[model samples]
Target: MGFHGIAKAVCRALTVRQDGPSLYDVCDPLLLKYQGGDPHLGKFYRTALGNPALRPLLRRTGLPALKDAERLTRLRAALTAARDDAAPDWTAIGTPVAELMDDIDVRHPQPPAAKVTARAPAMADIDRAIRVCGAHLLRSFARNGFIPTYAAFNLLGDADISGREMLMALTGLNARGYKNSTLLFALARIFIAHSPARALINPPWRGIAEPMWEPVQIRHRSAYYDAFFTEALLGFVETGLASSDQAGAARRAISDMVEFCLKTSAEEVPSHDGSTVNVITALAPGPHPRFSRFFAQIKQDLGFGIYVPDCDTTACAFSAATQAGADDPILDQPLVDFYRGYQVRAGANEPRVTVPLNDHIDYEGGVVTWIDNLNGDRPYGNDLDPTLNLDILEVSFRNLKRWKIIETPQRLQTVHRIIAFQRRLVESGAFKNPRSHIYYLPELYSAYFGRCYAAFVALPLAAQRIIDPGNVFALIRARVLGYVKDELIAHEMNPFDAALALMALAHLNAEIATFTPALHCIVQNLGEGGRRGPYKAYEWNKMKTPTRILVGGPEVTSAFALMSLALARRRMAHS
Candidate 1:
């Protein structure tokens, strides 16, 4: 047999254990004729294949051990199959309606001997902090008006994805749903944040505008965050934050974002009818390599780019465009159809296709993260995230209401299904556990949930009729008060977390005292010169690994701080 044949037989013979990473994972590239993609593993595999001594050892002993291990894994899974497939008790998580109104305080008890040192920030301090933060944000804006987002190695890495920083800053500023008139200066500073991204959509601003500085890992300027930028800009427009000319610019940016989403579909997949269709239903986190033909070749050869579209970005795009009055009927059906097709209905399909699963069936009705070109064989694409599903619920409702799109039975069914999924997911307290979410920290998840709930509730009573809010408000309360509030009182949260907490509390209309600590946290963290905070605001997960990328240094943190402090000021003045 040839070397390729021997490699395939060896891989097949290799044993994979149910409990851990296996030789199969290591040898998959050889069997599949694709590169492993992991740099460390790639090096190891090359050595194993080339070294004659290693090859002899692998053939003589390694293959049999691998075969035995695979057999054991299969046998163990078969033994637990019956117990694992049983559905979780969804009703058991439901709280009594009466109890939902009752406040459950879980504040940590402080020692009596300890003096009360942390005071609510004074009004003047808050105002000054806001000004300082706004100034910091303005200064952080690159020449092209983009805010830098960094990741942490030992400290924060270099400007990783500025688009994300801009989005988070804008989201924090508008968290209270305040009019743009009140935040004119801050808004003006951010008005051009989207321009660099928009320029990427229709380029040749090459000489005129400096491209946003990003690490080589981030290929496209849009890079999975255009929807977020689109939504942020649209928020400015709706809140009268943008002037006529600015609004026109915002709309143009929004158009570019939506068009980019539609045109970029990773690759085509075979439709149910056997004809191939561009899998354009969702927006991908891109490394599209549109700027250079060289990187495109690398992407094709090494599979370095994230080619699959995700539901979260797609939902953001839909809501942003719909609200911005960019009506595109062509996008509607495929999007609805993609969700319907990819939404999980049974056991984790294609186990060990990417990550290993131990026969759990809890993720029914939640849309999988990726809409890939795998047709029915989407093993890697079937991961479920409650946070992303909640995003879908929030954006879908907004889009439907804005366009007055006639909802299909399938569409309504999807709405009900994901809502059910979210309710059960939250009520079971799984949502509170950081392990349950793939991409977000628990506090971040709760903050987003609060923001989403507030937006949904604000939809006019007529528009709110589409999906029942059910116990979402109660869930938010439980999460914020029972869990998040305790964490705030006990721990020193970063400015980003504090800002998120402050806005969520504001949304809840909780007593000013409930979030004053968060406000104080933001105020006290202001670095000398008040240009930025002493801390970082956000840290993004790199592919859900332990290694986190710290996003937004002092400047980004200050942006969030400025917004939070401004909101606190407004609330305090009223009080």
Candidate 2:
């Protein structure tokens, strides 16, 4: 579809403000569309920006973009150099991908002070690791009490930025003359704890002694039951139960099928025997229905995060991670391989060129077959094709990043408070549930979560205090720089995750204006370029293909948009 088509769809999908559409509405879809065959949409975008009537409307809507588009262009050249290293020919005067990434990191380096490196899709395990790591830091500080990192009770000191993204953003801060690593490290360390998981792990149950029984953070304490805020954060409260049996049940189910398949694979043709018939049925003649069932079960098992019974609190106040015992049997690889030759192609076709083994597709024919059926043998970079993976790579970093900050910026003691509560549950055997149990999620245990507001606010504040964060005209250049960094990094990421990062970063920027009033200009200046990308029909479809399975989740996208809106409203009111 054309740009207009996407604009029309967006208008239909979201309820724009009574005053007009939000800046997100004005820009997100194109950024969401990012790539594909929609030149008409690009043309419309250019025209809309140029038009006299729409220009102000666009400006008034205010959005984020790169601070230096030209600088970003240079950054992209560096990023390409780095990415090319992903599959470098060492014989051709080249460095490996990892080293090149390090080099690029150095070239566009964020000043070093305190540092932490993390991988994507922050799973449950990472939580505990941080907690354990924090324990070491805490032990050193327990003798003298820990203090909040900011040392500023004034709300004026506040600005939203993710711990990691904001760390990288220090380049902007350094340009403005705030050259203190101790301060940034103190802030960076504080940045780690801003995750929703803290809602559960570090609940203030002692608040129960007060007139209000609910967690201390909630706006309505007495009105809402005890642990209400806890429930709001973690989806449930834990009673300290181990989920070994439920895990065993799921394991047994998979093991039985795996055994049957292993035995069946011994025989050449398919069997009608009952033992081997669990995953296969003669009704469809092909195993597609059976495969569908397998897929469903896999999702169910992994997604089955059970809620534990409440201990003088709301239900689901302390939920446990979906249990999977490592010793528990794994899926039957042989059984999984049964479908490898289910549909043999007539002739041998050369393997399609991809981003060099991007994923180890144990079961290949399926993803490609699905892609080909959607768009036939579109040869490698046929000039018409951008050849991108269409699967959603879900990300969960911002929530996790927000976890460490609950302590005191440096006060990891917040995690200890949470562990104390969990220990009570553990000793009292509150965690003995047959189906769901609350074990000490020592990893996820932290006091607070990291949040992002738009950088629009601080840019001008820094401008006034020391230097021009960016001139009114120069701010867009920075946004362009940011987008190139984001999109280039996204090359290695699944498109879905990439889209999510963009949206999250955009909302973060939008929020910044709330804390610093002058930021709205930065917000208005960068316009859509700060937060958007070129949306095209083909690219949208490819990205959406994986999203279709999860498409019913409008909640995720809407929540993100709401965050951006919250930031916008806050900024507007203050401005």
Model 2 score (lDDT): 0.22
Q: What is the C-alpha lDDT profile of model 1 across 1-575, one tens digit per residue?
A: 34565455445333322333233332333322333332322332333222343333233222122245654354233212211224312122111111111221111112122123356878877766665554444343323234344333211111121223222222222111111111111211121121121121122211110122222332333323445455444444444434586567656656765666556533466544455544443324434323246545543332233344566766666655555666666445445555666676655543312221211335777776765565343323335667777677767666664434335666777777777777777677776565466555566566667656766777666555656646554665666566656554345554566776776666556678777667766777667323234444344333321112223344445544554555566677788
Cα lDDT of model 2 by residue, 1-575, tens digit: 34565455344333322233322243334422444433322333333222343333233331122124553344334323322334322122111111212211111112122112132222232222222222222221232121001000110111112222222222222111111221222221221122121122222221000011111111111100111111111211121111454234323432332332222211223311212211211111223112245433432332211111111111011110101111212222122122222212223421331211112112122212111211122211110110110000000111122222222322222222222323333334322211111111110010010021222233335322222222321333234324323332323322222233333333334333222211221122221211211110001111110010101111121222222223333334464
Please give the clash total of every predicted structure, in order. 6, 62
Q: Give the TM-score of candidate 2.
A: 0.18
Compare the candidates by TM-score and give the number of the best one: 1
Residue 195 of model 2, lDDT score: 19
What are the TM-scores, per candidate, against the unseen true structure? 0.57, 0.18
> Model-by-model lDDT, in order?
0.46, 0.22
